[model samples]
Target: MALTSHLETLKKKHRDMSEAIDVAQRAPGIDGLRLADMKKQKLRLKEEINRLSN
Candidate 1:
């Protein structure tokens, strides 16, 4: 049960990070490195969620 709740939270964070990445991409002069970092973080969270669920 706890794992399920934590997984939900992680999914939310990943979604939020994805939205942020999209918004950043639309802005002028956005930093590519920072966006890449966010994507990495999101991927980490996704991996963790998968690990826990399985």
Candidate 2:
């Protein structure tokens, strides 16, 4: 049960990060480093979610 809840939280965070990245891309003068970091974090979350799913 705890694992399921944790997975859900991670999924939600991943979705939120994706949306943030999209918005940041549309904005002017966004920092490349920050965007890359966000993408990396999102990827990590996705990997964790996959691991837990299995």
- Per TM-score, the best of the predicted structures is 2
lDDT of 2: 0.98
Give per-candidate clash totals.
Answer: 0, 0
Which candidate's lDDT is highest? 2
Model 1 lDDT per residue over 1-54, tens place:
887889899999989999999999999999989989988998999999889889
lDDT of 2 at 43: 99
Report how far off residue 26 is in candidate 1 (Å): 0.6
lDDT for 30 (candidate 1): 92
Task: In angstroms, give how far residue 53 of model 1 lies from its true place.
Answer: 1.1
What are the runs in model 1 whose C-alpha is more than 4 Å off? none
Q: Report lDDT (Cα) of residue 47, candidate 2.
A: 100
Itemize residue pairs with steric clashes in candidate 2.
none
